[model samples]
Target chain A: MKKFMNTAETMVAESVDGFVRAHADFVVFGTDRQCVRRRHLTPGKVAVISGGGAGHEPMHIGFVGQGMLDAACVGHVFTSPTPGQIIGAIEEADNGAGCLLIVKNYDGDIMNFEMAMEMAAGRHAVEMVIVSDDIETARIGEGRGRRGVAGTLIVEKIVGAAAEQGRPLAELKLLGDGLNGRIRSMGVALTGVTVPHTQRSTFTLGATEIEMGVGIHGEPGHSRQPFSTADDIVRYLCETISRDIDVQPGTKALLFINGLGGTPPAELYLAFNAARRFMEERSIPVERSLVGTYVTSLDMQGLSATLALLTKEEMTLWDAPVATGALRW
Target chain B: MKKFMNTAETMVAESVDGFVRAHADFVVFGTDRQCVRRRHLTPGKVAVISGGGAGHEPMHIGFVGQGMLDAACVGHVFTSPTPGQIIGAIEEADNGAGCLLIVKNYDGDIMNFEMAMEMAAGRHAVEMVIVSDDIETARIGEGRGRRGVAGTLIVEKIVGAAAEQGRPLAELKLLGDGLNGRIRSMGVALTGVTVPHTQRSTFTLGATEIEMGVGIHGEPGHSRQPFSTADDIVRYLCETISRDIDVQPGTKALLFINGLGGTPPAELYLAFNAARRFMEERSIPVERSLVGTYVTSLDMQGLSATLALLTKEEMTLWDAPVATGALRW
Candidate 1:
């Protein structure tokens, strides 16, 4: 594991410190650096907060800014944040209205966030929206439900826009839950991720193999297949996602092709074109498109395809203004 | 060898098609898809045109939008654009105010762009800005001069903003030439880049080896050293740049930490923190910071650092609004 880092113990902490410094004008360290929060909080607006492991960068933390997440509780790489950290974020972000937690569906994350919600019950009105959009996990019947992946950004953006509009906490929660139903995503990994601390990949594959429907933390996917051309790989991803959502003909979607670290922008765009072609053949037009490395699994050479069935109103929300470290318009 | 591409011959073209489609609202293909140009042209403004090989994305093409580049001619991966392609860009971008061509200092690029200028001489008033800001190649005293690296973005951004303000061709060229002198950059590669056609790395390194001052095309660098910690590597990069540019103790700079490709955001931020500390120790304050994988060598696992001495006027230009595919503010 030839990573540009000092010691694995201090890597995540140093990265958090550096992130705050790099975007100081937009964000600040909150409560002994337990969380990163927007520098300027909006009064009487429902505060939106999110938290997770550190490897999937530009996610919870990068989303902390105007018109998006109010605060992000960061954790050690591939580990869930402590309840104290989540509580600190809640304390720093809650304004007169309340706070809403947009959480991915993971056992550790759900448990810690729930513990933090209970801890902060007396001080702030807190509601939670758990996102479980990875369709493969649901099909696998893990009994723990699906694990959220790249589609979290869609949920965050839409709910964040609604929050910025001063929507009631209940309404925002409902909107977030509704989005989870419409968004479906699946990912493929060409190379496994090596955890910084362990200095070892969670799994390994043969030279001509690829993993389909992999989770964000380098977890095993549904199957391993022979390495194929870009068009075939992308066709599989788009077909699986669209099939999972039962997207109908003439339906419009926001096709988001995301790189899961290590994949260059050229390949990401190439994958986007393949996915676009797939949708066009099905008569399912992709009304909006986003392609980049947003959520990542540390140095994993892979990409994910997400399709969100767009309603006219949801389209307006996704198009709404957002200013954050990783996202701005 | 493991890349998401359809075929070597079609990879760059497909990527360009995908990029134009993804950003249709902001850009369009020009003249048989030889270039990507702004969708809405601003008449009478000096058109800022740039072009180069395809691999380093979010640079020439991603910069084509409002308040930045007017057009970007693209060539095959790691190959210079032909004179015909450059001429197409000039034709598509130029409005009444003429055009400014920002060319990176490469032998092929310089020759082709000059040939294009000669071919289009009678049609439009054109001026050129040749950027050669990589300090390592200069220190080596090669007769060909330094290679332009990540600092080209600084030249494009400042000159692009000036062109957007209706600066004439000559003035924009002069401004871009001035910027080239103030900016310096150097990169390190942990692994060599693999071209899609070849399906083999340009160079190989031992498990504990790393290359310093590596070029964007995976060309040989100044030295190959044992793998070091992030802090030490960043220290070497910052110290080398400061010494080359003779950055005064009280000077201000825009510290840009760019990922070549494959390096994740967490590691990038960690490197940024080390650089910020290095400048702080020298009393040369970093007035602004930009970090991301903007200019990249396809799947090269490494990063580059760039420093541009900032004037109050240049600071304002840098702060001006820019809405592009990869950059927005």
Candidate 2:
């Protein structure tokens, strides 16, 4: 449970500074103590922005660029980026085309981004899209809300492409809604990630156990299940996502087998293989597939499967060009 | 170390299958214990393909798409993909426009991809570019070669864009070479990651030690030093990269603050900020900056920084639209 840092308090600020310095092409702004933005504003393009706790790398920030998000509000490690920060990002990315806030469906994120959206609407035309693609059925009853996991990236990519294509704010919102309906994600955590500030693993499981459907911020998943083969894990995840969104044969789908930080590419590929088999067995057609760590949870050892049901149009949008730190195409 | 797998041997293959199932829009091959291709391959564009060990998630596979890699070969977990796999990828992606193989400068990756290149050259014209961006000064004298780390992403993006633009294979090779020369990377690992098959951390580090210039496979770095502040770490990494290339103020550079698997984004941003400040103090002009888990070690708690020195042409290529699983732009 050790970390490489001077003090817990300075960790977030220090990280932000280093990020801006390394990415000078981005017009970065914000106090050394708070959230920041990239300066390269897409003049007429509808700006896309997102932010949340800091554990998910390449997420809110890595996504900023042409054909993606224009700005990302930074939050503390595992904490929501403040409303003020979101407001600043909105203002900075805002041009005549307005802005889109892609907030993950976490309680804190939803609350903060919602408040920021309200505040910004007073001065600018600000629109928002909440991604709630986590398909853990256990959370359906608590009303805690379906946690936004790896599927957030798909939402960003799809909606970001639409925004880049000059879709109006209202139309973009509809597109976001449409994409969300077509997407679902489920995850399994083998071990917990130690948050640097806490210097302790965020959650714990037995060496023989896997926490099915865990959220990114070290939240316990629906249940702790006996560890199984990569194939079994894929079955569990695919079944969950498919049940949530009826993925039928001949349906064009985008599969994302995402690493939850610490899982190796090999393990992710294994999980992905099982998922592909599951689809093939059912004669379902996989139009596009991505396997790797897109959205991550620090170094937690786990993987999440995100299914984006694609129409021909969505597939075309997925093919649109993009330039971002994490995603280039 | 808990893991989500029934057997160690099947991990990589399963993950690859799941990846294709999840994104069916992209044409996928190799679900049958072999190399794979994306179906979205343009008919006339020169295909870009890259691959290596399985631990480096998103490096080879996540980068496969429209403007990036046309296909990716996934090796066994933590092992290089076989020559047959590489050849398969090349053949699947080849479309009259010769294919470019972007191989990272690893002994295994180099040897395998080289063999594949030779095999493919007999039938389809194949060109290769070796990326050696690791700025680990320690490896300079080894004569073995500098291990390609996160900087491979830059090579892939630039070259992928060039290929997408229908550049000749020779021109793409030169572009890849130019990017390799301009890009430099160095990393520090807080903790080692365990390869699932091995069931042990790839390497060992102390509770209060950071391994500087660690490789993606969890190889031991140049030295284990006392854990320091993010600023100090950034300085060490940046100075190492800067020494390898002349990065002056007003020179636009693409800075990448990449996570080595387990490092949190918060910490990455802190490191990014420090790097930015250091460069600002020195008047180094950073044109574009990226912070995220691009090329990663399975949940290794560390970060790496890559500086892609941008010329006008390189910058244009860098800004080109790319479509992939992990990277959008």
Q: Return the top candidate by lDDT.
A: 1
Q: Once model 1 is optimally superposed onto the true structure by TM-score, how far is the C-alpha of residue A48 displaced, in angstroms? A: 0.2
Per-prediction DockQ comes to: 0.84, 0.43
Candidate 1: where is the Cα deviation over 4 Å?
Answer: A139-141, A248-251, B139-142, B248-251
- Model 2, DockQ value? 0.43
Highest DockQ scorer:
1
- Lowest summed lDDT across 10 adjacent residues in model 1 chain A is found at A243-252
User: What TM-score, computed on C-alpha atoms, does each candidate reach?
Assistant: 0.98, 0.78
Q: Write the per-residue lDDT of candidate 1 for residues A94-158, one digit (tens) a residue.
A: 89789999999999999999999999888899999999989887767766789899999999998
Per-residue CA lDDT of candidate 1, range B1-329, in tens?
A: 78898899999988888898999998999979888999999999989999999899877899998889999998888878999999998888888788899988888889999999999999989999998888887656656689888999999999998888887888888788877888989999999999888888999999999999898987878899999999999999999998888665444699999999888888899999999999899877888999899999999999999999966777888999999999899
Give the root-mean-square deviation of each candidate in angstroms.
1.3, 5.0
For each candidate, the alpha-carbon lDDT, in order, equals 0.90, 0.76
Please write out the lDDT profile of model 2 over residues A1-329, one tens digit for every residue: 65545688776556555655555565465544344465666677788888898878767677776777777876877889888888877776788888888888877888898888898876878888888898784375546567777888888888888888888898888888778877899888888777776688867888788888888888778899888777788898898887788764445988788877666555666677778777767666666777766687876778898888887787888878766655655
Residue B32 alpha-carbon offset, candidate 1, angstroms: 0.8
Worst 10 residues of 2 chain A by lDDT: A27-36
Candidate 1 CAPRI category: high
